[model samples]
Target: MITTSRIRVWDPLVRIFHWSLVAGVAANLFLTEEGGTTHQWIGYGIAGFIGMRIVWGFIGPWSVRWKSFWPTPSRLKQALRPNYTAASSDNITHTTLGAVMMLTLLALLIGLAVTGYMMEETTRFWGVDWVEEIHEVMANALLLLVPLHVIGAIVESIKKHDNLIGSMVHGYRRVQIPPQHMTKHVDDRA
Candidate 1:
C-alpha cells in the first residue's frame, strides 16, 4: 500500500478564503444578475476577501506567507529548470507560473472591483464606456484563468501523487518525509 505523511499546510482562514472567492466569482459570473444588488454584494465580498488575504500574507503561517511563494528571480529560475519536477520535490507549494498567475489574478480582481464601483457612480463616471469595457475584459480574463488554474492544479497533483484539490478543501497535503526521519517515529512508537 502506498502511504505518505500528511501536513497541515493551509490554515483554516486560507482555505475558507480560497473557496469563498471561488464561489463569489462563480456566482457573479454565472448566477447573479448584472448590476443588481446581489452581484454588487458578491463583488464587495470578493474585494474584502482579497484585502484580508493581503494582510494575511504578511502575518500568516510560513506555508501561506508571501515569502514562501512570491516569484523571485532565483525561485522562478528553479521552477523553470529543465529537470525540475513537482514529484521530485518534497516542498510542494506554488510553482513559478502559479505564483505569477496568483499575482495577476489579485491585480485583476482589484481592477474589476474598482471598475465595478466606478460604473455605479453615474454622477462621476456616466457614459464612461472604457470603464465598462475594461471591466468586461477583466471578467473574461478571469473566466479564462479559473480553468487554467484548475488544470495546473490537476497536473501537479497527478505528478506529485497528492490530492491538491482536496488539500485546498481540507487544509492538508501529503508530504514526503525522508526515510531517515521515518525511523525516529517508528522507534518512538515501539
Candidate 2:
C-alpha cells in the first residue's frame, strides 16, 4: 500500500464556486421553471459566479490559477498522448484535457446566459427564433459536456490514486511524495 500526505489544493472559494455553479446549473436545467423569475435569477447568479471565477483565475492560488493548468500546445500534446503517466511533474492539479473542458464549459455557460437574457429583452430581440435556438443548443451541449466532465474526473481520480471528488468537496488532495524527496534530518550523535 502506498502512503500519501494530504495537501490543500482547492481553496474554500474555489470549492464553493464549483458546487454553487453546479447547483445553479442543475436547478436551471432540471428544476426551475423556464423563463420564470427563479430561472432568470439563477441564470444571473451563474453569470455572476463566472465573472468572479474569471477574476479569481488571475489572482487565485497556484492550483486554481489559469497559468497552472492552461492548455498550451505542448501540455495538450502531453495530455493527449497514449499511455500517459500521471506521476510526471506536469500532472500536478488539472490535466490538459481538464483545462480544455473547463474553458469550453465556461464559454458555453456564457453563451447560454447571453442568449437567455436576450430572449427576455422582448424588444431588441423580440420574435427572434435564432436566439432561443442558440440558447437550446448551448443547453444541450452542456448536457453532453457535464457527463464527460464527470467521467474525466473519475478517470483522473483513479489514475492519480486520489479522491478528486472528495478534494472538490473538501479542498484537499492526497499527494504521494517520492521517498527520496521526503524531508530528512541529520543525527547529532555521530
The CA lDDT at 135 in model 1 is 92
Q: Rate the local accuracy (lDDT) of all candidates.
A: 0.83, 0.83
lDDT over C-alpha atoms for residue 174 of model 1? 72
| Cα-based TM-score, every candidate | 0.88, 0.88
Candidate 1 Cα misplacement greater than 4 A, ranges: 1-3, 179-190
Q: Please, what are the lDDT tens digits per residue for candidate 2 over residues 1-190?
A: 4346666778899899999989999999999998889999999999999999999999988778899889999987876788766545444578788889989999999998899889885688856999989999999999999999999899888877888888899787766656554332211221
Residue range with the least summed lDDT across 10 consecutive positions in model 1: 181-190
C-alpha RMSD (angstroms) for model 2: 5.1
Clashes of each: 0, 0
Model 1 residue 110 lDDT score: 94
Give lDDT tens digits, candidate 1, residues 1-190.
3347666778899999999999999999999998789998999899999999999999998778998888899878887899887577545567777888888988999998999998875668755999989999999999999899899899988887888999898777776776654422222211
Backbone clashes in model 1, listed as residue pairs: none
Predicted structure 1: lDDT = 0.83
